[model samples]
Target: MAEKCANVNDSDCSPAKKVKLNDEDAIENTDERNTSENDATPETELNLSNFKVTKVLQNNCVRKSICIKGTFEDREGLAVVLLEQKSFPHDESILEKGFFDEKTLFRKHFTNDIYRNYDCFPTEEYNSIQTTVIYPATQNHIEKYKRHELYMIDETYELYQQVTLPYIESKSLSLEWITNILEHKAEQESIIYEDSDKDTGFVLITDFKWDKQLDTLKLLALPFQKIKSLRELNASHLPLLRNIRDAGTTAISKKFNIPASQLRIYFHYQPSYYYLHVHFCYLMFEAPGIYVAKAHLLSTVISNLELMSDYYTKAVLSYVVFKDSPLYEKFKSRGALETSTCETLDCK
Candidate 1:
């Protein structure tokens, strides 16, 4: 019978390793290893599960070897002994204990109260694979990662989506085109309003729905004829300010302490802005590096915002708010005032 290979990567197969099926035939087969294959015998099932600790090897590294079994279904019952960085400086013979501790330890504190409910999945890049599947941990966040973006899974084993800031990619939607679309959309939908303060010099105000899924304002364009140079907005404009803090080891320096350098512009809506407070807090944590700590800090802060922000105000104006509007949600999650109570939208 002819044997077939499936699911396994090409690198795993070689002519030298092909199984001799019969007197004259050699099969380079990668058969389905699913547990449900009817042909698999009970004895085979027992052997599959009978994984035992075989060997542990560590060379020229600060950490020791850990070996386990049954964790990997495809491998020959030998599972790698993964250890958290905190567990380092341990005894090498500890591998004989059969199982390494599976507990996770947090080195630094989480500022969910000050920040909000935010989780960052570290990025994993495979040059061979050209697709990306975004698995956002929460419904509130907009997962923004492209196919070619470089990423890595950190010690926490979370995928971080790498982003290049000041990455200026301009969509074709210009102010004039956006204005036309809004005007047409407003005429059709009676709910929207367009106001131009002729006396106040070309300042146009358009209001529409706020889309929660897209995290964007439903309205296409702001009525302002021309927005001048935008500035880095402070906390005073929007009462809801969620600040994320993660202190890593390398960040300890003189420049960051005197004045916090803004890390990234997370949300920008006219005068209202939200930034990830990475520099100050991350430097203080004494983390080995910035990547893991930054992701943890940003994720925790966003998570906190989701819990406190008044959903009622955000709910009604959902249509006007741009769909997938990360900016609005960033502020709302940080604890925005009740839509009814906050009369002043003059964030600028």
Candidate 2:
């Protein structure tokens, strides 16, 4: 049962500009993608050939993963493609002529790009939130973590001031992308609901990964107020939480024709960014941050606030910290994690 393609190079299966539809980045590239041998995500179905590039939002060709975020012709959302450039195979580098020099390789393979003043020049510089997982959906990896490692974080006001506040203030995160979308500067079509409540107002937008598909629905609702993370929430912020759950969810369901019952609404404790936002995804869709370690149910947060005015302000939050996250080092230094090393968690 060994069928062979006459010219593998020309075959559809052959590696042709290997790219991936990264869930973290909210875009998809297809066919073949390069990855560290152990970590492989499920491949999504998207035909970028039909996509006509209108603008290059970001091109991080220098990072560990070379990615380019862009806008496509007639397409409303953003699309990110990780150009797998210089990761050339060793055998392919066995030059049959003059020895390979830096200049020769640069001339032959490197792609030159020009960035604007405000562009996310070296994409590695910014930190963004992500919810999907590409890891093999094995019962062991998923089920075991939920049973053993998941812990609820009770973030007391004192703990937040001592631990969380300092780390956020230290890292000057770039909020240019969020700011652009809110001010009608970018991804205007992706906007689902624009709450003009001022104090509790927010702009909800669909995830770029959806690509107009509703099967695996996704969205991000950014609050207009600079509330930072869930730790800042109290009963006073109930309007924001409830608005996201009700108005936001309703918009998604009505626009997409998806029922509200199928939606899973929640917020991330240690959100990828310093900005306060809510995540809405299909209940059947299990993204990376949906786990108890990170995701806090929107309804649960509402209920907790209703019970006590200062529930979140005085709660003892318990959440996971990856071995590689900057927060992990901060927590370890302050003895917040209860161990010098984190053996069970992932590497951020």
Candidate 3:
């Protein structure tokens, strides 16, 4: 569930402070059998076994792990133990070498496999796999939006700074995934479209989405800088859009052995992420977010910006908000949307 940011200026908008654990209690609970040869005694051995199960995390159907509270002896502060389900039995050798040390554990465990899987597979092979299947929006969702306006241009950047930025900085989900893609997968896999240069401008990468089961190619045009949604775009970003379209068309067509005309390039108003990105999918595929109220075609966006420099900036664009969305409530408070009659769907 997403948390609502009541005020952007408040300290509540900042990342949540992590709780500190007592190190002495944790060290005292270390099992004697797990102690290293060099430090077998209680005084010498670093006790790590005194962990209290704080949370259980489940990833897909295949794996689950416990998040434990503890502190490493050598480390200055308290830490959390993310116990990953190992394929092999607990290895004492790893413990002796400090493999599960705070720093090492953080580096290894704090990542999503959905993003990391791109690194393991060849780009062509990865692109071919059907990883996601999105269901069409229900009548409930349709009716809820019917009463409320979708795009709140004025609130876009404010919501990003308050809600999105803090989550990325503290939770390290989308931000980390993006960093890994740029660092590990982009260049080697031909995913990079334009590297940010002083002359040409902002960095952009074009890559196929993990889900492409529709028997047609779908690509993503992601910008490196933090620009929240299409609402933030203006004439200044025209070059970036053009580059993305040109580069994306060439890359997708060549890789999939299809013509560029078959592709439909567009942008979603209320994107899943705050970062500005364009979507390129097969024209034949009735993609989930392509409706008039939700999607704005890239060609149209570019043309609009060209005609009026502050078109998006000043324009009152319409976009959908579900009955359950906090944004929906916000709109209701401002009387931008009528009180909804449709029931909120079980979103998760």
Could you estimate the TM-score for every candidate?
Answer: 0.18, 0.56, 0.48
Candidate lDDT scores, in order, read 0.23, 0.56, 0.46
Quality of model 3 by C-alpha lDDT = 0.46
Please, what are the lDDT tens digits per residue for candidate 1 over residues 166-191? Answer: 21121111233233333443222211
Model 1 misses residue 288 by how many Å?
30
Candidate 1 at 196: error in angstroms?
A: 1.3
For 230-252, candidate 3 gives per-residue lDDT tens digits of 87788888887776676666655
Number of backbone clashes in candidate 2: 12
Runs in model 1 lying further than 4 Å from the true structure: 1-176, 181-191, 198-221, 232-348
Q: Order the candidate numbers by TM-score, best to worst.
A: 2, 3, 1
**Backbone clash numbers for all candidates listed:** 59, 12, 3
Q: What is the C-alpha RMSD of each candidate to the true structure, in Å?
A: 27.4, 19.3, 18.5
Best by lDDT: 2
Question: Between the candidate structures 2 and 3, which one is better when assessed by lDDT?
Answer: 2
| lDDT per residue as tens, model 2, 1-348 | 122111110001113211122223233211111122223244433445645443332233222222233444544555554333222223434432213433232223333586323312212212222222222222222222221222233456786898789888875545676776668665555565677567777777766545333556788888788887888789989887887787776676656667778988888877766788888888876554787657888999999999998888777766765443556666656666654234646646
